[model samples]
Target: MTQLTDPSGQPPYLRIVAGIRRRIMDGELSPGDRVPSTRQIAKEWGVALATATKALTTLRLEGLVEARPRTGTVVAETAPARPPRRPSPPASPSEQELTLERIVRTAIDIADAEGLSALSMRGVAARLGVAAMSPYRYVPSKDDLVLLMADAAFGDETYPADAPQGWRSRIELGARTLWAVYRRHPWLAQLGSLTRPLLVPNLMVHGEWMLSALDGHGLDPTTLFDIHVLIYSHIQGLAVHLEWEAHAEAATGQSEDQWMDSRADVLRELVDSGRFPTFAKVVGAFDDGYDLRLDALFESGLKALLDGLAPIVES
Candidate 1:
């Protein structure tokens, strides 16, 4: 409750760091204790959120604090002697240092760490420590930046020169490759839907790979493209939930498992109601509760899909 400040006129963030550091050293905040969050620090110190974030970053660099996923920042297990003070804001990169590739890569990193919803031009600029409008000078707009991000994300993996031999193996390779990209960047799946597909060139590279696998199978143009789309949709449909689950957890402060467990009573009521006998039997059959592993589901679905399409392509 006391005011936090240093008499020597240190910056506001440094003063906050000194206060929290004092608490940790004096055993007022023990190891594993939840330290004041950025929001809390901002409120208590009457400084901006950016300043609070910088204070925490400084503490983290010094090994005095660590961030836990669901849990906020906590005092680290050990606190070493404080490192020498650094400037409040590190020098921003020169204009010459800012390039389109750097901006796109930084934006992708933001979307990967925090969902795409958290991304913004200003936020990206702040992370880059540049002016608000700096990225726009390169990217023009967030939508364009997202397109570039998706293109880069999709281009991460490619088909090998020695193709997998069989058409089915080739198809599996392409599908799994795309799946890996989605798993790496879950936000990629949320970019476009079947009705309005993403038209990026790198994405088309994936499409080309899959279509080429089906190319010489003697199928007509329509059927060939249809098969390719079906396979793509299979990977993408399940992938859409990845980002959705992330957003749900952030919004509700509960993981998907926690949220499902919370609905046990409702699940029991449904079982007892007996309106859906098959659903009840399935739910009751699990000795240990089912763990929804997306990777396993992706593989299972891919196998089933390829099996079904085998006769069509082979015919």
Candidate 2:
């Protein structure tokens, strides 16, 4: 293959760095696999030797790759797929020395699997196998713990640089990302009221991205901000229901479909009682469907909103 020079407009190192990350994420490189060497990158990407080295250096600093003496360089094995555990650092004498990261991360896992209501310092401590007071040493209060947890969850997914071109695509990406994150940690959607935001930098970055997507759309500032608020509310409102259903199923050990079936059986009995034929017909028509799928509904509604906004944006 002919050696290619770096594209002129974009920085050579950054372009090279993006190419490597894309390969990793796209599964061209798997966990525990060897990453390309600087020499390999230079040859493959057709960039200068120095540019390739800088690309590798940036990837290493970002925790995407690491170097070993015996092995030249390999993709970092510390990502989530590798299963990182809390550092069982030898018990130190000073209890207060325990890092806040461990405490916050543990709490986040709990809130992720279980709902937010299940989280408490005692619960986090139980999970950590540490004394109840140990968590308090790191996090001052449950509110502080939750705030930190929200930030950590948001930090899980970073926005892709040079996102797809066009304003609508950008807004769709932001909305979809936010919705996915909240869906994963459903409790996060319910944490703060619209009036008082989360005060987390990462969450603010989400808002900033949304605001930028609205730029030059010809919407007034109030309408632009309100549109974002509406989108957030639509996603969060559905997510709360999703969390509620999951919690109900977990407590009762019944799948949502089964629970809905039982409720439908009750409704069928009412339908047979010879009153309200219209209601009976409506309920009977939808008996065999799956339970409410909130994520799908959120995506659908977001798309509809975007469709309605397109004409205005183009105008």
Q: Model 1, stretches more than 4 Å misplaced?
A: 1-91
- In candidate 1 the C-alpha lDDT for residue 277 amounts to 96
How does each model score on lDDT?
Answer: 0.84, 0.74
| Model 1: per-residue Cα lDDT over 1-315, one tens digit each | 335566765668778888899888888998899898666777788876656766776788689998664466789987765544664652477534888998889889878766788799998898788999989899889999999999999998887888888899999999999999999899999989999999999999999889999999899999999999999999999999998976765555445666677788998899999899999899889986677888999999999999999999999
Index of the highest-TM-score prediction:
1
Candidate 2 Cα errors over 4 Å, as ranges: 1-97, 269-279
Error of 1 at 37 (Å): 14
Instruction: Give all TM-scores, in the order shown.
Output: 0.75, 0.65
> Candidate 1 — number of clashing residue pairs?
0
Number of the top lDDT candidate: 1
